[model samples]
Structure formats: structure tokens, C-alpha cells
Target: QQQVKQSPQSLIVQKGGISIINCAYENTAFDYFPWYQQFPGKGPALLIAIRPDVSEKKEGRFTISFNKSAKQFSLHIMDSQPGDSATYFCAASYSTSGSRLTFGEGTQLTVNP
Candidate 1:
């Protein structure tokens, strides 16, 4: 069973701080790992991602650290801000799925000003 689970459904951090979230998966069939950021009322946009073959990937202020042996992954946000407040979803799927995504429940991040 390929399932992805996330922790800390919500997070509160002051501006200029760092926010961390964790995720775990159950299946090895998943080949594509992606993190998505969603605003209040819009579709999720790709944040960062890594393949099972990679250990880490970083984009702008966002980073994804993947652990293939443990079948786990995580998202790290640096220098967080109120403007960065949003919901984040960690997802995984096979490339063969044609980008079809299986997502974690979500993490709502609140950056206090």
C-alpha cells in the first residue's frame, strides 16, 4: 500500500523564523516526490521535490530532504514570513502515473508578524 502521512497538521512561527514539517510513505513504487504550496483558494503549486534516487533538493527558500532507505522525506522552510503563510502538501507518485499525485493531508503554516 502506497500511502503518505504527514505530521504537525498546523504550524505557527514568527516572521523570519524557520518552519519544518515531516512526512513518511509506505510504498517503494513511488518514484516522484513533490512538495506543493497552496494558498487559501487555489490549486497547489510545486515547491520542491526529489526522486527516490536523490537525497535532497532545494529551490529558493524551500528544501526537500529525502531518505530513500527509510522511505521518508521532509520539507524545510527558511526565513519564514507572514507572506509565506499557506498550506503545504507533500506528495508522491510514480512517473509512470503521468504526474498523478498522492498527497499528504496537509500542513497549515501561520507566520505571525
Candidate 2:
């Protein structure tokens, strides 16, 4: 079974603050971890990702901190802005699965000015 459990159904962050969302997976077969950001009336977009081999990954203000032993990962948004407000989903996938991904419930993040 491919499933990812994410915490905090919703979140509110102030402008310039850090916003964090966490997720955990039960399937150890997952090799790739990615976070997706979705805005209203639009499709989800790839935010950041990490592999089992790496402990963390950062792209601009977005960062993915992963723990292989714990099978857990988190997304951190630095200097959160109102424009960054969106629904985030954490997903796991393996090479054998092709583009198929198992995503978490989803987290709604609101960055207030």
C-alpha cells in the first residue's frame, strides 16, 4: 500500500516567517520524495524533492528535509509570503512506478501580511 500521512490539515504563517509541513510514509520502497504546491484553479506544481540518499534539499526559499531511517520528510518555506500561500502535498514514488505517485492528504498554508 502506498500512503503518506501528513500532519496539520491547515496552517497560517506571517509574512517573512517560516512555514513547515510534515509527512511520513509507511512504504520503504519509496525512493523519491517530492512536495507539490497547488494554487486555486490550477494544477499542482513541483516545489522541491529529495532522495533516500540525501538528507536534505533546498531550492530558493523552499527546502525538503528528509529522514531515511524514520521514513519521514518535511517541507520548509523560508520567508513565507502571501503569494506562497497554497495547498501543499507530499508524495512518494519509485522508479518502477513510473510517474505514479502516492500523495498525502494535503496541507493548506496561508501566509498573511
Candidate 3:
């Protein structure tokens, strides 16, 4: 898909809790799926990624569940911590297109201690 749209715009999760967010896209041609985490004044870093070839992917406490038929995906942050507070973005692109991603509107997550 070309554009990924995310919801809520922000989230507040308690420490040791789980945070969930959703996203949908418009294009099915996209193959690479990546979630990026960014703090204030910092560039987004790739947190985790999965391809349409896979149903899910996880990295440490971060996980991404993708649904190809639905053209949707989600980011799950487990055991939320204050240090996990940041802005998260869901992104998708294709290697055939040189990995240029169309990012979501972004969700600001704050984990309370």
C-alpha cells in the first residue's frame, strides 16, 4: 500500500502494562513492514519489521502483527515502561521501490511510572 494511517494520535499506558495501536494502508503492493520509535527531537529508529511474507514479527518487548488480507498492521509494546515513552510510527514500503516508506500520522505514547 501507499499510505499508512494510524489512529488515536496518542496513548497513555501504565508501567508494566501493554500498549496497542492500529494502522491501515491503501496499497497492497507494499511488502516490507517496519515500525519506528522516536523520542522528542530524535530521528525515528526501526524498532521491528515484518514482510507480507510473514504473519508476525517481534523484537524484544516490541512486536508487530500484520494482516495482509486486511491490509492492516499493529504495534504492541509489552510491559510498558517510562523509558518506552515515545512517538511510534507504522510504515510500509517495498524493496523493489528502494525502501521509501509511507508513514502513518504517528502515535504519541507515554508510559506512566
Candidate with top TM-score is 2
Clashing pairs in 3: 1-27
Best by lDDT: 2
- Whole-model lDDT values for every prediction: 0.91, 0.94, 0.90
Q: After superposing candidate 1 on the true structure, give the runs of residues whose Cα lies further than 4 Å from its correct spot.
A: none
> Looking at candidate 2, what is the lDDT of residue 78?
97
lDDT of 3 by residue, 24-58 (tens): 98888898888889999999998988889888888
Distance from true location, Cα of 14 in model 2, Å: 0.6
Give the Cα-based TM-score of candidate 2 against the true structure: 0.96
lDDT of 2: 0.94
TM-score of each: 0.93, 0.96, 0.94
The segments of candidate 2 whose C-alpha lies over 4 angstroms from its true place after superposition are none
On a 0 to 100 scale, what is the lDDT of residue 8 in model 1?
A: 87
Backbone clashes in model 1, listed as residue pairs = none
State the TM-score for model 3: 0.94
Cα misplacement distance, residue 4 of candidate 1 (Å)? 0.5
- Every model: Cα RMSD to truth: 1.4, 1.1, 1.5
